[model samples]
Target: MEKLQAAQLKKVLKPIHLWAIAVGLVISGEYFGWNFGWAVSGTIGFLIATLVITLMYITFIFSYTELTTSIPHAGGAFAYAYRAMGPFGGLIAGYATLVDFLFATPAIGFALGSYLHFLYPQIAVIPAALVFNVAFILLNISGVKESATFSVFITLLAVGELLLFMGIVGPHFKLDNFMTSPMPFGWAGVFAALPFAVWFYLAIEGVAMVAEEVKDPKRNIPRGYISSLATLIFLALGVMILTGGITDWRKLSAIDYPLPEAISIVLGKSSALTQIFASIGLFGLIASFHGTILAGSRQVYAMARSGYLPGKLAQVNTRFKTPHWALVFGGLISFAALFTGTTSQIIILSVLGAIVMYMMSMISLFILRVKEPRMERPFTAPFYPVFPAIALLISSICLVAIVYYNVQISLIFFAGLAIVTLIFVILGKHKVQILIHTD
Candidate 1:
């Protein structure tokens, strides 16, 4: 892992600013649509699942916070692993993360399509997907400020609608709906929910990607990741439970847009408030996907600057100080996926990629702690061995769940990548020096 002469990161994003971007991306499609599974799993089971995932998320956040602030380079997970392990580890993590972001763009694009359908019933799904791809591309190319501003507005609107809708619908709640099923499919249902559940918990790592741009990253990165993730999990728990209490689980399971339907049922479908909620959900998803494009591209730039990726990918525009090639490469991948199978399938693949990356990240944390005890880390993981160990265990469990859910192709793809990365490592190590670049 040789770091060359790379462009310095412009400190354009503060820690809270990045958190706002992440929160914006998260609140859109995820909140409105996640309850569909809860309908089948029952309220108590769903609540437990949410709690487990949220805790695991915070734990992972702490581990990443230590890595990001210590390194504060462009390659989020990729560079972290490379610095701790070797070029081979870096390549594997980098490629896995690249695949995760690539598929994630389209998955979010497809969500944009679904939300557009809800808004304009007559709009074609294919067209909506393409529109999302192009719109996000333009937004990302424009600059970070433009993208974040739009995202903040749409995200806040969506959050407001979600909170208001939940408040209005809560009074009509029934407790029996939550306790009706006791993990109905037992272990199978838990496995079934794993992919989607993991998907729901994705993107909390966005704060780490902008570490270089953050003001006082040593303090802010850790704070933003835990605080923002905690906030998101709280909202998710409330939405899941309230949606369960207010509506029949049976009906919600049957409907495609469960949250919107629950809102319509409580407020009446013809009401203007109902329409506003639906509209916010629609545009909010587009805005969220837009923010993802912003975060994902910078990671590519980071990897490229570290010399794990093609040199061209690391190039930033002189005027914009933006990773131009990284943005285009990411957009092209998302555009390609737009024409493929269902968005849900793309989301599954993306989740699989993320799971693998998280597993590698956990491993890297242990290795770094053992190998570099004297290295400076502005933020440290709480409880040392315990937090990372728990995070690793949870990640492994989620991997099993993903494989159990029949995403074997994604697993196989990741395995093949590992083999190739090992080959690259052996080939590169003898021929090149492992350089660690810092000012």
Candidate 2:
């Protein structure tokens, strides 16, 4: 093996850019995917699931902020886990984070296709999905600052679209419609819906994956984390309630373009208002699709740099100062996934990976507190053990629920993990090293 040097990332991200990256990485969930929970649990059952997942995220984000600020690495959960638990633990965390972000990118890409198809009926879904993957790869490889600036602009537009969606649909909201078929599958449906509920805020943690690129990470990372979480929580709940209440949840439950379908219910299927909203709604999906590419590539670069994967994945483009190879590799993986699974399957598998990440990250936080008491923490999670404990316990339950309810996807997730672990043992074991660098 040849010696490899760390490819330093530019520190160009501010608090606003970090917040946009965080929210943009997830805003598409408000447009689609979360409604699939309605198919399993019905509106009320999914709501119960969303509420539970929301609590888990609230606590998880607070605890996670401490790790991101203290470590300030692009590896995110993997970095924290590595610091506390060594190479094996880092591999687990890194692999899970990769699974989470990688799957999420394709899911958003698929949604992007669905949105485009809604606007222009002649466009094929797979082709549109592939186009998005390629276009975003170029944008991401161009440079982080350029990509993040674009993300911020699109994210604001997406937010405005949501607010407009709510304004148009609010008057149509009926409590009876909202409560219709509240728990058709009962408790089983609630458990079944966990993955879709997770889609609402799935990649918010990916913000931490960009810590290495942020300006003044100690001050800005926490603000970005908290503000983004707050914004997502509000948007997720608002969209779910308004969309669910405006019409029968069944109409939009399985579709890739739920918000547009919901808008059609009030404005008529062919109304200009419906068409305009659907076209604008594409911005929401674009924000997330673009943002996830930025985050997913960073994770690949960080893992590769740390010798958990092939070194080629860590190479930076000389002119752009970006992880060009990682971006392309991640985009190709996402494109392949676009053909392999339905949006729901993709989402469940991604959430399974995310739950594992949450559990490991919270455990890493606890271990670090005990094992490295003197480590500088610019910000501490409020309520200490309580917050992380809640996050850990809920994440465990969500993981078990997802596995039990979606056994096939769960097996696929584990199989991917197994393959990654095997490769690590064979190829990465000797190469793994503790990376120390100051940004």
Q: TM-score winner among the candidates?
A: 2
Query: In candidate 1, how many clashes are counted?
Result: 0
lDDT of 2 by residue, 390-411 (tens): 9999999999898898889988
lDDT of 1 at 282: 67
Find the 10 residues in a row with the least total lDDT in model 1: 430-439
Task: Give lDDT for model 1.
Answer: 0.71
Clashes of 2: 0
Q: Could you give candidate 1's per-residue lDDT for residues 245-317 as a string of tens digits?
A: 7756767763336666777888888888777777766655665677678778988887767666688988877
Give TM-scores for every candidate, taking all chains together and pairing residue i with residue i.
Answer: 0.91, 0.98
Highest lDDT: give the candidate number: 2
The lowest-lDDT stretch of 10 consecutive residues in candidate 2 is 430-439
Off by over 4 Å in 1: 254-256, 415-439
